[model samples]
Target: MRTSIVFLSALATSVMGANSTTYTLPAGFNVGLVDSSERSAWCSAQRNTCPDICQDGTRLNSCDSNTLDFSCVCADGSTPDVTPFKQTVPFFVCQANYGQCINSHPDDAEGQRTCKKNAVCGSKNATEEADSSSSSTTTAASTTLAMATSTDSTASQTSSVAAASATTSNPAVALGGDMTKYSTGFMAGLMFVAARMIL
Candidate 1:
């Protein structure tokens, strides 16, 4: 009986040790979309464009302390402002996706060739030139301004400046995320281990 008890204890300890081994997942192990408001989270939704910015496990290059968003800082000798949003431009000026430059026209200039090929030139001021068709453009411009200044009076001005700067830097960064993704990796892993034990 003494020998049998010792054997059972040893076996239990061995089994417990095996189960206690921690799995060291790679950096950024989680795969999911990051909310713009999540300061330390990686925005995996824009993977193709910002792959290095977010590692497979959700490891981010750097966190934008100001905005509380994760940013992929360029590697050594690499430039971070590859996107057009990095380029500084006017805050009131309307722009397209990624500084593509949406050429807004006054109702009077319809069909008028104001922009060069691939170049967009729009009204200097949206409210002044907007009509039925241009209503959306006007709304977008206004929304951009409003969002940039949604904070308190003092911070509102500063936020507007940052929003404008982001637009000039990379439209993707400024456009933000439209969808959300979540990862069940940890749960799945736990289930797998539980099944193994039961079997």
Candidate 2:
């Protein structure tokens, strides 16, 4: 049993070096692959430690294994269908979901336009004339600052992110972002394993 924990821990540590994100899905656990609304009710019952920052939309939120599963809810607690006049931007998910609105020409090249120069729905939002790219910059910076200021101790948590995002030569610590949730997921996965062993 001790050997099993060591092996599993080593395997988990190794897998964390990949450069992408992933959660440890135990056998028979649902992955929430479908639309957020259609996700398992039990999963939806799971709570995300972080508040949803979606400006205004029926959002698809995922939780670590410790919680039930995933969730879909309006960011502003409004009817999901009463959207904020959002459009699916062609390529970037961020731009598609979070682009601002403007009243100027669609191709206005000034630094004070709505969405970034890279967004497809660059001319949407609420106001027809008062769009500002500066808003997006401020929003992005605020989000970064929020993540940086999140309350989590590195010493108390473990991460698989380091394995998935960095090279094996140097395992990087999870600096910010979803590391808190990932750590919760990892701990939950470990608990699940231990429970199975006891059973």
Candidate 3:
């Protein structure tokens, strides 16, 4: 449970970033669609052409956080290539399905090219509305859960930022279950705050 709180905090932190599409990821996980432009651009510079494909559950060498250069990254925080890859790999921006899909326009700036990120809890229409209608049998708990979600979304939605939160009874479980989502470490950070509130 404590570990879940930490993850929530991390999610919150990721959501704090402006313009990022944040979402509720499972415990110990946070996915976000951030502007990987620098990394993407660097790859383009190296390959001299933007990649047109990216498969979900696959890591593409694109940005280096430490150096602000391209590096390999995955949803689970894997960075196989700390530096740019000697060879180009599959790279695509986050699409609407929330899974890494074929880039319709890989060269476009963040949020310009639209695609579905699979079931991201915070995506434009993927959000769940926790309310009195829930059948969880914990009325107060449900309301608290709803409030936490509302708070995060209300705070981040203006910029269309995807934020994630959970209810008191189950901090380890992500509040929304219907969508795949992505974002920076911000969503976890926001969720941490929410979890702390529950504690």
Candidate 4:
């Protein structure tokens, strides 16, 4: 009976650990729709493009024929971003094609050509852009705080900044909170069943 208890405890620990495993996307990559067209074309583009983009490992998430939606991401299991369809594509040709698809005047050949050309030329490093934007925001906030001389205000600002930084640095905290709750309940139920069987 004691040995059974020990074995069950070990099994539960392993299972819980497995449940906690989370993957984050590498820098400059995002989970987004590669294309939206016919089922065959969408699926083909997703399957072909994701591997080329995320050579480490690729996860072709979903392809909806009716909705004409298809999405893919790295195998690391990053959460899908809001407005992912509008996010920049890593490849120049894909970006240009996406621009063409979103063109206001789809039937106009000249407009389509201009849109494609602009997209290819305007493609920028997303990671660098994000870093610069965040840094600038932080600097601006710091400048505002510096103008305030109150001790209580400074303390409040410091705490708020710390909390914001914590959440941003560890995205899994928000994502895994629910998973942890579910896993705890599941493990408790399993142990209860095992104890009853052993008794």
- C-alpha TM-scores of all predictions: 0.19, 0.19, 0.16, 0.25
Taking all chains together, the TM-score of candidate 2 against the true structure is 0.19
Model 4 misplacement above 4 A = 1-39, 79-199
Rank ordering of all candidates by TM-score, starting from the highest: 4, 2, 1, 3
Give per-residue CA lDDT, model 2, range 1-199, as digits (tens): 9999999998865743331122233333233432444233333332221122234433334433333323334455432221222321111123322233222344665632434543433233433212344577788999888776663534223343453233322212433433445576775665565455434
Candidate 4 on 15-45: residue-level lDDT in tens?
5444331323222222344343534454454
Q: Clash number for model 1? A: 13
Question: Once model 3 is optimally superposed onto the true structure by TM-score, how far is the C-alpha of residue 191 displaced, in angstroms?
Answer: 85
Please report the TM-score between candidate 4 and the true structure. Answer: 0.25
What C-alpha root-mean-square deviation, in Å, does candidate 1 show against the real structure?
Answer: 37.0
Q: Against the unseen true structure, what C-alpha lDDT does each candidate score?
A: 0.36, 0.37, 0.38, 0.49
* Candidate 2 global lDDT: 0.37
lDDT of prediction 3: 0.38
For residue 72, model 1's alpha carbon misses the true position, in angstroms, by 2.7
Best by lDDT: 4
Global CA lDDT computed for model 1: 0.36
Determine the backbone clash count of candidate 2: 12
Per-model tally of clashing residue pairs: 13, 12, 55, 0
lDDT tens readout by residue for model 3, 50-120 = 12111123233343322233433344444332112222322222222244332433565543333333322
Better of 2 and 4 by lDDT: 4
